[model samples]
Target: MDGFPEKILLATDGPVSMGTATRAAVDLAERGGAELHVVHVWHTVPSPHARGFIRSGLKEIGQDKLEQQVREIVETGGTVAGAHLREGQAVEAIVDQGERIGADLVIAGSRGMGRLGRLALGSVSTGLAHRSHCPVLIVPEGEKAWPPDRVLVGHGSFEDTEQAGFLGARLARTLGVEVELVGVTSESGDAQEKLHDLDRELESRADEIGKVVGTRPRVRALVGNVPETILGLYAGDEKRALLSFGSKVLGGAGRMMVGEPLDEVLNSSRGPILISPELHPASKSRVPEREQDEGPQRPAVLLATDGSEVSLRAAGYAARLADGLDAKLFALYVVDEYLTFRSGVHYGDFIKSLSENGREATGKVRALAEEAGVECEELIVLGRPDRAILTVAEEIEADPIVLGSEGTSRIEHVLIGSVSEEVLRNANRTVLVVGGHPEYARPKGESSGVG
Candidate 1:
């Protein structure tokens, strides 16, 4: 299906961090043995009175910037196949050049802004993601290097998912890293059941991808706020992971913005992102079509920890269980608001202490999951530990909730009113409580008894 990029287009603006885009383009070109083309599109004068002189000056500046970038690429041990300087609107010029050259991928740089309203993507990058016929790789200003350790493919609609998965899997293979396909569904209906169905569908899709890509991809389906959930999984260790997703074509007859979830991800992600526009035609003939009612969900195992010794033990078990079951792992550490408020210590100091402890607790689980080669999403939130655990489990449609039998006074509160006894009474799902005798404890969710 021509998954591997054979021709790459690097679109640069004079002022933005062109070096970042140049380096990424070179690295990708070297890895895939692709031809790298550098292009700089200069804005033309609007008024006809000063058009000839101003336009000539702009052309000279564009040529110099384009040559400078080519030199930087050569200095960085990359060969540029072609250098293009065009006069027009930046987005239109870049897209036209990409299409004319039949480029497989387009690489560009963004400012990487900090706020939601002011997303990092400038008009050009956003426009490329929306209008380009090929996949666009937007390298943020602050990103370290290219050829990430892993590629995460975010599922959208059926066609988008198929195209994104194919491209992401190819990139992962070229980089010699693992690829994971993740789908996020809204928090409605039977989340667990939806997760189960999603998991099955992803498995099926993964099998098909394996047949083509020569390696089966790991799959995950989560139930929660769509953008937030996807961003959470994509968070932490941003430089090491590359997120690739299909940017669904939105808006009607007029020009459209980048749109919801992609917009949020662009604002929040501090890493390199690959956006495959819906108009990308490469996967239409390659990936087989599938009909489904709605996007499916996947299975996840939730581990609630308090940073106690027993909780660490439970974390290990949770990681192993997720690995064994081929499921995603959700590590949650909730700061106990009620307990912190009731403590005689100062409120701010006590809350800070809990937040630090929560980070440590979730960090341990992340490490354990990494060791086991399990995909783990770490979350540290503020609330009553038991209530937080249940809420997260329900939100993520976690099949089993893991906890420790014995803990500190903080967990002692959970044991008394929330965790073991109360959770067992209320939770409709599985509750695995790791106690002193780990071998003798039977998981509460399943009917199978373990002696």
Candidate 2:
């Protein structure tokens, strides 16, 4: 079960902005018995008709970068299979060479703590990530990869995540490190009860990961926004190290996409990130072996609503999707706590009306789903709408979080009602934002049971 990458491609430009990539790559290669290819891509090669005057300078720059890598490899005692100096686009050269070398993974840099304000992927890394032939692990800062005592898996229910979880667990097992399944939750009432509930729910999935990696994983859930919540786990302790997850990437074979959540994680955290390819080429199937007999299982779909026609329409779309996958439909009605955040004589009335309206809206959605022959589960939680939706999705481990593209029309609500938009941006899995606008949705009178 030694599935470590035999050919590892480490892409770099110079020493300045590689963040944690170079150090992580060296240690990973040395430990996993992977042969490393340190590639420094340069666009200095002259065109067929261009002058040769600048050729020497470009070559010098490329060689200098390669020298730095050599020094790094020597220091880390890592084996270098090759030192590549390629021409043309940095991303293109890295990807092409990676494919030619039959690379199992590409290690690249992210713009951590850079001008992007700790929230942007470097342009070259972004290009390589979206266009690569294999999975790309982006480390945020320059830190040695050895002494990684813990491996964290961003757990979710997406089919793609199966590969991520199992692969990460297997790697941790091989490295003899601890594995943790971290999720973000937004449950109310009791904090201890919420954590227990999430942990209990994750037990089944943790067992699956344990079977793969040969040890059970510890499951944990924390309250907060999705990206921030997960990134917060890093905490720079340096002992609990290496974060791994599965993300869909663009291009062929994988047919999966790495969405905004991953981008945010790479930008905000300075840790080694291991991303599993969507297709799971090693296993050659999205689901595990035992489940293959059960056939292709669709991801559970979550549809958020505010009881508007627009939201109902989105629920309809979600139902159709659930029917297609033969999966359960989760109809979530979020009573936006923002409505009650302000105190006044009208506050209690607003809270009661909003909660009742939320339940009513979810009831309608259940009817819609049942009529379409899709089994539906209804849940109502009170919190900031976006964070609540994300937390509930994590609680249920919904795969694709579906919602209306817009929200209620109240000026305050609209300003605050960007819940769906925010969910679409930050959700870890596939987000189906149906329709173009919220204009045709139910009007505000519906909140007071007027409609």
Residue-wise C-alpha lDDT for candidate 2, range 300-415, written one tens digit per residue: 78888888777888899999989998888988776554444353423324444555676688889999998999998766554557877776676555778888765556563464
Q: Residues 70-148, candidate 1: write the lDDT tens digits.
A: 8878877889999998888677789899988889999987653344212323546755765576789987665464657
TM-score against native, each model:
0.57, 0.56
Looking at model 1, the pairs that clash are 113-120, 195-297, 198-296, 198-297, 199-297, 430-445
| Candidate 2 ranges beyond 4 A from true positions | 16-20, 45-50, 111-121, 144-147, 157-160, 188-198, 236-240, 253-259, 280-451
Best-fitting candidate, measured by TM-score? 1
Question: Can you give the lDDT of residue 262 in candidate 2?
Answer: 59
lDDT of 2 at 159: 24
- Model 1 Cα shift for residue 84 (angstroms): 0.7
Each model's lDDT comes to 0.71, 0.68
What's the TM for model 1?
0.57
